[model samples]
Target: MRITWIALLCLSLVGCGSEGGKTGAAAEAQPEQTFSWKLVTTWPKNFPGLGLAPEHFAENVARMSNGRLKIKVFGAGQLVPAFEVFDAVSQGTAEMGHGAAYYWQGKIPASAFFTAVPFGLNAQEMNAWLHYGGGLELWRELYEPFNLVPYAGGNTGVQMAGWFNREINSMADIKGLKMRIPGLGGEVFTRAGGMSVQRSGGEIYTSMQTGEIDAAEWVGPYNDLAFGFHQIAKYYYYPGWQEPGPTLELIINKQALESLPDDLQAIVESAARAANQNMLDEYTARNNAALIELVETHGVQVKKLPDDVLAELQRISTMVVDEMAAENPLAKRITDSMRVFAKQSKAYHGISEEAYYKARGQE
Candidate 1:
């Protein structure tokens, strides 16, 4: 009886050990350590398109991660200044950042290509190049030195030329004009006899109001209307030749991103992608209605930028882009990639998007 009782106890202990092993393994499989991250941006807290994109990204990540990861977002000056977003993310002061890459051109001379090239790719084409045409790889390579990982966070489709207090009748009007523009477009504007001024989104109103800038080229009518530019400037110009498609960046700290579990990392990537497209969708839907209000309700004069002015800007844009490419080898690679892709896109779009627009406009 003693021998039988001892064997049964051993078996009971073995069964308990097996159950315990299973429980431990299951626990290991589940990620229970939650991480809280801070995301900083070059936008006001929840201000329309530029600001709202980051907020939406945070929400998407929380919903997808199911609380495994949470990101707390800070608008410009809340955690860091708008222009400090790059430094904040790279130094791990913040885990993520949102803004255009060109904002960092003072630090990275070739940074403008990732954001927007003057009269280059439109929104759809820009998205394609980033995702498929090797644009993202170049962006990563360029940002790697900063210890950052770049994602195409958001895009403003073709933007308006800007709000001008003085009418642009010809190339002569562009001379000696001061305007708030960014990226390579700003450079082109400068070369075209206009003073290219740089100001963060929040400061645009005060600058324009105080006559610090004679004109400001912000985003589309939807975002521009929200800023009440109609009250500031009467001439709302179209055909944003400066930024055909400005792809805002979601820059993440390399170390912080790699520290996450595989699934959480994937969650972040997926969420960024979703937010990128979501901004475009929201802008596409909202810009039209806001423009109607700007014209009919606000009595804003909608004007087309004269062809001569566009032609001059285009000529200068090509020259500067070429000069920029010549200044650096990496710029050459990026410009070549974009130009080749742009050629293909333009050819196809001529038949598809451009043709369809023409056909639709006639109706």
Candidate 2:
């Protein structure tokens, strides 16, 4: 009886060990956990430049993660209205959002720094400031209270002033003029004696066609061309003063981001950086072609904004941004950082980029 019992016990132990080994192997090979996220945007679905950037970002994340993660994108009015993007992401209605930060200035006045400052950093300088000059830290700090995190997603370089139906010959011309402008630039326009109308890209064409707005400033050549602003307005102006280098943002819900795995978190961040540079590259390459097409094929009159008008607008921009900064201590910190970085960048570019450009343009 003892011998029989010993053999039976050995058999039982072997069976148990085999099962345990199989379970261990199965656990090691378990399917990688997958995550799905939704992203909402302020631009039209897959529209060029601004609209396409987020799509590009989503694609990169998917490819980099190798099916471990996926993101779905909803354009303006698809998942939510354009203006609601910030709120949707903040409240966790969406996992991610793509838009300019200045759009939410009503909620946090200091939000404008992450987007653009009137006469502030240009595309290159803005990137340097955000990624290298400690601007991103301030940006993240400003957004923390709202339960959101921000990333620099895209840039429009130096945009054109805008499309105008009438000539801005002087400050007299600006008086009583209605223009579709937003953020600090809009405030500057309003203070310059013009009525600034807040309207999205979809609304601008109709407003201009119906004579509701005398002028409108969309993005520069690439986006302006895509919107076909040339069809609605006669004069296309250069040097977008309101948004010298507007940085589109990728705002993510802090909770949703934290829920991602460590590797996924790294993937999301790396993809954003790549997508950000991809957009600037696209604009730098495609904008000139679009501008040529507008001027040559569409008979659009491409003109430089008058020097005096630009100067006056700059003066107002300085004052308006300063006052805005002073209104909040946080904004003061944000603007102080921007001012310091801009000064340092300007000092270097004055000798390098600016000098090169001047030499290239000489008679």
Candidate 3:
């Protein structure tokens, strides 16, 4: 009887072990599930750098995930209007949105810091602030209330001031000028004596061509050239002071994000991070070639804003930023942090980019 009992006990132990092994193996073999998501952007689909970046981001995500995760890309006005993307995502009408954060300032004043600040850090330094300077955490906290999870989607490096039909020799030139500008730049311009009209890419060309807008600023050379702003305007200006480093954002719904599996969630965040880097590189590479084409092949005339105008604008920009900060607590924190980061970056850059350029001039 004792020998029989021992045999039964051993058999039961083996059975338990086998069952546990099977459970482990099944977990390992869990077929990676497939999912489809929708991404909407502020720019028209495939519309140069701004629009094309989202398409590329989606392709990269799908390819990298081995088709386990798929995203359909929609351009501005296709799924929603350009400015409506934030609300669309927050309300769960769409899973994701791609656009500049400043466009959402009406909802969250701190949104401007995620995009850019007048006379602020350029692309490289701004990335450091967002990723390494505790800025991203603050950004997420601010977006949480809106049920949105924001990611750095892309950046247009230092941009051009824009194109003008007439010369802007002094601050007086901007007076009464109807300019197609967007975001915080528009607010600053309004305070500086210009009438700022917020228009989408499709509308800017016609507005300029028909003389409805005397001036307009888009992204730098690559996009400005594609829009054919040169044909309508005689002078193209440089140093987009308003948008030193405009970071495009990927606004994902918080609930939608939470529903994603751990792996899928990681894949989405990683894909956006990769896209942020890729976009800046794309703009840097393409802008060089596009600028050459604009000046040489297209007869586009490039001009630097007069020093007096730039200085005056910068002064007004300081006041505008301060006034906005005073109205919003979150905006105040972000603006203060941004200013600190910018000052540190400028100090370092003064010895590097600034020094290099100065030395190059001597050569």
Return the top candidate by lDDT. Answer: 1
CA lDDT, every model vs. true structure: 0.92, 0.90, 0.87
Which scores better on lDDT, 1 or 2? 1
Which runs of model 1 end up more than 4 angstroms from their true locations?
1-31
| Tens digits of lDDT, candidate 3, 1-363 | 366976787576745446554445666686877878889988988998789888988898898788988999999999999989999999999999999888887777768778988888889988999999878988998998999999999998999999998888888989999998877888888888999897877789999899899999989998988888878988889889988898999989998888878888898889899989999998999998999998998888889989988888888888888988898787788788888888898999999999999999998
lDDT of 2 at 290: 91
> What TM-score number comes out for model 2?
0.93
Which candidate would rank higher by TM-score, 2 or 3?
Answer: 2
Clashes of each: 0, 0, 0
User: What lDDT tens digits, residue by residue, belong to model 2 across residues 1-363?
Assistant: 357976778576745446555445666686889999999999989898888899989998999999788999999999999999999999999999999998998888888878888888999999999999999999999999999999999887888889998887788888998999988888899999999898888889999999999999999888898888888899988788888888999999999999999999999999999988988899999999999899889999988878998899899999988898889888898899899999999999999999999999995
* Candidate 2 stretches greater than 4 Å from native: 1-24
Superposed by TM-score, candidate 3 places the C-alpha of residue 328 at a distance from the truth, in angstroms, of 2.5
Locate the minimum summed-lDDT window of 10 residues in model 3. Answer: 14-23
Quote each prediction's TM-score: 0.93, 0.93, 0.92
Query: What is the lDDT, from 0 to 100, of the residue 163 in candidate 2?
Result: 92
Q: Alpha-carbon error at 305 in model 3, in Å?
A: 0.9
